[model samples]
Target: MDLPRHHTIRESSHRILDPFTDAQLATLGRALHLTPGTTLLDLACGKGELLCTWARDHGTVGTGVDLSTVFVAAARERAASLGVEVTFVQGDASGYVAESAVDIASCVGATWIGGGVVGTLDLLGRSLRPGGIALVGEPFWRTDPPEAALAIGDFVTLPALVEQTRDAGWDLVEMVLADEASWDRYVAAQWLNVRRFLDENPDDELAPALRHELSTAPLEYVTHQRPYLGWGVFALVRRP
Candidate 1:
């Protein structure tokens, strides 16, 4: 989807859209060696949850850039509310450059930077200093990706994702699989926001379509796919 619609949908349901869990966040924090002074660049940072949380807990300095102006605004608001000084910019994360090299560069759940994992790492590397960590949050099919799986949205298998990263000069530092409970939380939380949106704007043009999509999504997700799909965080570091 384009920026306008994508931002609208995400903004409408950012609260419901649980992007990560406690374990996943802890894993990333540990992998990045998050500290008061550690700096990270979050590419394609959707609403800047990862960066904002890290900044608040770890006292780290970070920035998140996304193409969605609405998300950028929300992220900025989140940072301010948390009293963290994270800079959220509305820009193209695919090519956004930092003023200085960073210690950790991540593109969680957004591999559009390099068109895939390999390319995303290459992009992260360009912005990292020596010995920096590159974290990628991705979804991996729990089993082999069937031909019919192509009907599903943007995702690749675990093996293929690992292969691509290794081939791109990275070593897996850590990995944490998101349990089914986490997935349930992530999906279920969004329904609240969708419901709220529908309640507030009953006459909205897209409300019907959004409601239909959400109503059927869980069934399609659990029955048709959840049994065979996995979500995880992969933290990799550039080799010296």
Candidate 2:
């Protein structure tokens, strides 16, 4: 629907499509000690960067599901280009069920697919083999939230976020946090994407809205998101 369409447009120029730099993502894969033949399922796997890169770097096999048709196509193309054996599917990732239990079940940066972080962990758990890992990317508060930050919804400070993860029945094994620069890198690129689109399709119905976002988003991010919000991909394992 509109969400997928908007995402495709907003992130057209992205490869990883999250706040993570390529180095950080590679750090995660290495920290996990990824082995050849590891099987992974990624839900809401935008552009399938995580899966595709892991497949190439660690010899992992993966399936990635996303709602954006163009993203899915791009993912497939990326896999082919990398000579990695990974599958990409276009569909509603919220209800995706992997064909089989996988060594890793991940829903990074798109936990809304299962409502929120805990629910997403549960969803990923459903497709994880025993002893498998569940990877979730989520936002946490870095400092005391201002009144404006409260509107960001349900995000707690880092310690509480970790506690919440533990309460959700997983042990947080490893994490990779995004800094202010990373946030800027992820969002500033969207401004360029929107500008390019609007320049080419000035008459498009979405143009005005995008123009509004382009005008307002940078300030909003600098004022609120950059200082207060921290995002990270967390590696989880079932609690004993």
Highest TM-score among the candidates is held by which one?
A: 2
Off by over 4 Å in 2: none
Residue-level lDDT of model 1, residues 21-112, one tens digit each, is 86668676876667898999989887888888888888888888888777787788888888899988787888877789999888887786
> Model 1, residue 220: displacement in angstroms?
0.5
Error of 2 at 54 (Å): 0.8
Best by lDDT: 2
Judge candidate 1 at residue 38 and give its lDDT.
Answer: 91
Note the residue pairs that clash in candidate 2.
none
State the lDDT at 89 in candidate 1.
78
Report the lDDT tens digits of candidate 2 across residue range 1-240: 525366778899999889999999999999999999999999989888999999999999989998888888899999999999999888898888887999999998999999898999989998999989999999889999889868767787889988988987899999989888888889999999999999999999888988999999889888888889999999999986
TM-score of each: 0.89, 0.96
lDDT of 2 at 235: 97
Model 1 misplaced regions, further than 4 Å? 6-19, 145-148
